[model samples]
Target: MKIFQSTTHYNYDWEHVSTANWQKYSPWNEKTPHVIAVDTLSRHVDPASGVLRTERLITCEQNCPKWLTAILGGDSKSQVYECSYVDPKSKTLTLCSHNMTYADLLSVRETVVYTPSAHNPESNTQFTQTAKITAFCGGWQKIKNKIEQFTVDRFVENAAKGREGFEMVLERAREVFAQERERMEMSQRA
Candidate 1:
């Protein structure tokens, strides 16, 4: 699976924002060998303001490592940012920024678009220009289900294993401590 770097924003306020030039941030630079873009329309109501906002987020993908580190931070693992929309009506640009680490951004549960690989038809290439148009509603459902199941199973298994290992170590330590205490007691009595 080819993993491409991507930047995404979600607007949940009653405003329309447009990006003038994403390239200015140098998001495409670094180790990214391939670049792709996708956009999605969504809406949400702000609980505090009681304002409904429609947002169209354009996600751009790149394979450059340096660019990824600059945007997401660290050595480029994966990242996602839940940003507040800035209504700059003058510039027609919505500003979204987050104070998060690369790992934190990678943990955002955003929609993923899967595309067919051009270089190798058999490969399940995860990035493509066509992803913007494909119906992703159904695919996201499947991906979410699998992720939930896997995460639950992994945590359960690890927790059980950790408890068992801790018990074993505790038992061994108890035995050693008891023996040492008994020897000290006998020497004092003599």
Candidate 2:
């Protein structure tokens, strides 16, 4: 079995970013190693509780994880993630997730937190992502340490590719945020 944990961080607009729905920062990209498509299986926002629940199939268009290909037996490029997030009133949006498709193939989970800097709220928004992936492989417990290290090396490589994609997402989000602000201002003037 192979397993790993990784963290990533980025900055955005503190105020406008918090005002947007999480959809503003889409994870899909046409680039390598990024999700080829985001199939929204289900989505809902509870008006009473101000909670958003989203179920999506994140399909990776590129090559599958080598570990998954070697040990697992099915077409394993896509994974389902169930997410629960709250309103961003506090300039924070935290998402806790579960990988539904990982029932027997591999286990995956992530906690993504978005927060505005307390000291620089007007200018900066911080995004922190903490994620883990554990592949279920038979035997080789004695070599578990080596397996883990190798998986971590692979994970870091994949994460770098993902980061490049997300940076593109971030820049697009910034453009959307600016457009929203311009529209709002124009409406107020009208």
Candidate 3:
């Protein structure tokens, strides 16, 4: 078993960062070539708490080590089940995801949270992520450790790329918003 944890800050506010989360897999994020598709399984707002809950299935191209792929089979894609909660009142977003493919041999579970940064609450957002990797291979401690470590390393690399991609998306979103606001102002003046 292995655990990976990371924390970072986004220059954008919580609202914009939260909005960008939904567009993370959009075409703007070319850094995530592995991600192929995302399907929303369900979505609804909780009447009591006024929180939004969503479930999705994400599909990605398999990019495993040759030896690992040999053991897992010839499949070329992997799937993940993700659930998210958005508390608008609290300005927090939390996402939990688990690997749905090859669970018998290995498992990866990840949780991510986005919230207003303490240092700059109004203009900055904090991002926190944690992942647990476990190998279920029987009587093979060496293989298990190797798999977990490899996964951890890969995850770290991918996390950085994901951030870069999201940043690009956010920048594009901001530009569009600015243009729209300018147009609205012009129309109002007219």
Candidate 4:
């Protein structure tokens, strides 16, 4: 079992980042090699906290590290997960997830939190993703380095793509809010 922690900061408020995570659809038509598709199985909202929970089959393209692919028994299928997006309050939001399909051969539980920056609270969001991995097989040490390096690479790639998608969503949200505000102001003047 291995645990890895990574943190990424975004130059936006927590709400903006959280909203993007929930609603943003990337420009996936451009062909995302690592992520092929996302299929939602079931979802519900927590009335009390307003957290959105979902079960999904995430079709990851066959781009895994060679060693990891070998570990997956050379199967050609996607991974499924049960995930949740926590409600936003003040300046923070959290996303939690657990893997379902690979529970025996592998296990993963991750928590990603988005928080506002202290220095510029209104202008920045801090994203921290912590992932725990467990491999239920022997001979793991032989390919430990490959596993670690691949994990790091994926972390970076995901962050880059996530940032792009989040920014587009946040910008669109701002534009819509601005338009609404202007409309309300004009009506008041009339």
Best by TM-score: 3
Q: In candidate 3, which residue ranges exceed 4 Å CA deviation?
A: none
lDDT of each: 0.35, 0.60, 0.92, 0.65
Question: Which prediction has more favorable TM-score, 2 or 4?
Answer: 2
Which one wins on lDDT?
3
Ranking of all predicted structures according to TM-score, beginning with the best and ending with the worst: 3, 2, 4, 1
TM-score of 1: 0.27
User: Clash totals for all models, in order?
Assistant: 12, 0, 0, 0
Give one digit per residue, the lDDT tens place, for model 3 in 13-122. 99998888888999888898889999999999999999999999999997667886787676778999999999999999999999999888789999999999999999
The list of candidate 4 runs beyond 4 A from truth reads: 28-36, 45-55, 64-77, 100-103, 176-190
RMSD of 3: 1.4
Put down candidate 2 lDDT per residue, 18-108, tens digits, no spaces: 4443443254332444455667678788788766667666665435677766666556565546564646455567766656654564566
Model 4 lDDT on a 0 to 1 scale:
0.65
Question: For model 4, where is the 10-residue window of minimal lDDT?
Answer: 23-32
Answer with 2 or 4, whichever has the higher lDDT: 4
Q: Quote the lDDT for 99 in model 3.
A: 94
Better of 1 and 2 by lDDT: 2
Q: List the residue pairs that clash in candidate 4.
A: none
